[model samples]
Target: MTRSLGFGVLLALQFLTRLPVPVQCPWNADTSRWAVRCYPLVGLLLGGILALTGRLLEGWLPTPMLALLLLSLWVALTGGLHLDGLMDVADALGSNASLERRWAIMKDPHVGSFGIIALVFLLVWKGTLLLALLESGVSLAVLVAVLALGRFGAVALLVLSPAARPEGMAWAWKQHLGHRDLLLALWPLPLCFWLLPGGMVLFAALVPFLLLYGLAMIRAFKGINGDIVGAAIEGGELWLLLVAWIWWSSAMG
Candidate 1:
């Protein structure tokens, strides 16, 4: 049981980040499915790293430059995986094409103009929000909480969402994710309350919005896939950062 859970964490790190998960574990559908349960763990670890970076560089660099550097580190850590999904989803949605055509566009190796613009806007928005939060004296813990919850959102989507295709990583994950797995995933929920300022209330409000967002993505794509899941994770992270800043600003005022 211990080994299984350890592999789950390993698989999650391997899948979600560019980190070298040096130890090889038994690879199978079961492990792949179980790995989703640890997605938030990976997010928390990533958040911790970012939080440390913020703390170490506090007052050492200009706000804008610090935010930019953190954003770059974020992209580098995740290998731009979710950002790629965000861009693909944007391009597909922008095409105004049929579902089949949209899917093809997402699968295409080349990025479109819409993808480029969307990526730019997302990065800029996140950087600006980070700058605002740092300037407002918000703790790095808030950022960590946001990152953790963002990945938790992804795991929730996986458990709740139907698969768009019978093949590929999404389907493989879906096949293994059960109600029990979902329960296991929720173990990290307490981290939100411990890490954020108004986390409980904000989390309560965020639930419906996340549900609605998931529904919209499913409606737009006809079903959820790996790309949609990634997009949701990225969107949720940015949304939390924005919400945190607003909450912090109002509180300070």
Candidate 2:
């Protein structure tokens, strides 16, 4: 069981981030399920790196530059996989076309004007939020929780929602996942609560956002897909950052 869990973490790092995982794990339903459960761990790893970077550069660089650098590192770590999904979903939803047409738009290799605009807006907002959080002296624990919860939201979508298509990465991940898998995904929650001051509030806030976003995706595409799941990760991060900024501001003031 320990070996399987280790392989699962490695597989998740390989699949979700640009991190080097030198071993090849055989892909099967069990391995896939393990990978799904470890998604939040991948997010925690990313958050750790970002938090370390921020701490090291805190006094040396201007807050704006540091925020931009952190944002760039965040994207680099994930190879912009979730950003691509965000852009695709933006293009598809902006088209206001039929469901079939929107799906086709998502598959198109070329990004549309809407996609470009959405990308710009998301980056700008995230960067701004990062700047605010940093300026207010955000805690490393908050940073880690923000990222872990964002990916946890992805796991939630993967397990709870039906896939838009029968064959895709999201569908494959969902295939072997059951309600029991959600308990495994909750592994990071206690750590988050222990680390952050108002962790329960953060978790409470995330649930409604996911529910509304999941429902919206279902309404938009009839079911969720890899793109939808990716979009959720991106959106969840943004929302969590916003919440953290607000919470920190109120506390500091």
Report lDDT (CA) for all predictions. 0.85, 0.89
Residues 105-138, candidate 1, lDDT per residue (tens digit)? 9998799999999899999999999999889998
Across residues 55-150, which tens digit of lDDT does each residue of candidate 2 receive?
898889999999999999999999999999999999999999999999999999899999999899999999999999888887867778888999
Candidate 2 achieves a global lDDT of 0.89
What are the models' TM-scores?
Answer: 0.96, 0.97
Please list the residue runs of candidate 1 whose C-alpha ends up more than 4 Å from where it truly belongs after superposition. Answer: none
